[model samples]
Target: MKHFFIEELLPKAGGSVYRLTRMAARRALELSEGRPSLMRKPSSDKVTTIALEEIAEGRIVYNKEASSVSSKDSTSPRAVLMRGNLASSQEKASVS
Candidate 1:
């Protein structure tokens, strides 16, 4: 298989090669451990390739904000626990 070049994947990963590489590795590890893929049409591609494609296609997003959030006090609104799906669900419930 023709592997993806770094250039092709960089922009999708917020133009940070290091971040792309890190997230792709993490995602690839998840795949290797039998995590379900986010893609609709699954190919026989390797885990790493699938991961890079997922990032490129926006199926996965890098969480650069997580680090900053973690550094803040837990009570802060931007804390890690306040930024994920649960927080969004709570917001929706309040707005309804």
Candidate 2:
């Protein structure tokens, strides 16, 4: 079992704990429904734990669009990286 602090997770959900809970719940449900985990080796077999690990590790990107159904729009789920929201993956990993 891992301990997840609110401070570590708040920004991932746009600083809203409610959204965090909602997002986590939704991801957890997907895992329970047999969705494959994004993690190479999930921390646990438990669906909820796997979901949280995904979120914590930045494997899950938050869909900013208010309307969940947005295939016609942006905000695609199951994306590995959200360019606008975080540091570019291509940027050199050197601390300045």
Candidate 3:
């Protein structure tokens, strides 16, 4: 089973994203299994409910590093070199 944050669900429901009220969060937790609740106060009047699963842990990895690479003259020479090596290796393998 996958846990979803209430705020995450809002986009899926096509509703305005807002913090889930404690009442709302509690209700959702009560109805669901094995999911933890995260509460956030976004404003004086509104408290947002974010589920633990909805929050990103920290970093994200993408397989296509080329999209993230900047320009030919990027500061990270090692990364660029590695990408070029991989591309060249692929081309050579494909040609063979």
Candidate 4:
């Protein structure tokens, strides 16, 4: 497995470059004592779960997904509260 910093892969000059597989990069990062935050791809039948403890304690932060303001029929206050609660739970899990 090989992992290189983003700066190494993409330089200010910006030229074509080949890369290692995600799994390989992940292993390399792990060996280098670096944590990689991978982006989730949208797909059916695919679930993304993170063990908060897997990340360093006190590093968890919450960010809300964008909602349309003009969509009058969308987004209930209760749903927003639930999302906040979920974020809190994740943060607590990391702390524990």
Q: TM-scores across all candidates?
A: 0.60, 0.67, 0.18, 0.17
| Candidate 4 residue-wise lDDT, 1-96, digit = tens | 222344533331122232112222322344245333222321221111221211111112122243111112134331121122456789999999
**Model 3: per-residue lDDT, tens digit, 32-88?**
543322323311222122322222221111123352312223464321211135577
**Predicted candidate 1 versus true structure: per-residue lDDT over 1-96, tens digit per residue:** 746778877876668877677767776776787776777665646888887777766667654556221212335332222123557789999999
Residue 8 CA displacement from its true place in model 4, Å? 44
Candidate ordering by TM-score (highest first): 2, 1, 3, 4
Model 4, residue 2: what's the lDDT? 24
For all predictions, the C-alpha RMSD in Å is 13.1, 13.3, 15.8, 15.5
Error of 4 at 95 (Å): 1.9
- Decreasing lDDT order of the candidates: 2, 1, 3, 4
Task: Report residue 33 deviation for candidate 4 (angstroms).
Answer: 49
Clashing pairs in 4: none
Looking at model 2, residue 21 earns an lDDT score of 78
Query: Candidate 2: minimum summed lDDT over ten consecutive residues — where?
Result: 67-76
Query: Candidate 2 at residue 56, lDDT?
Result: 86
Candidate maximizing TM-score: 2
Please list all clashing residue pairs in model 1, or write none if there are none: none
Candidate 1 TM-score versus the reference: 0.60
Q: Candidate 3 or 4, higher lDDT?
A: 3
Instruction: At residue 14, give the lDDT of candidate 3.
Output: 28
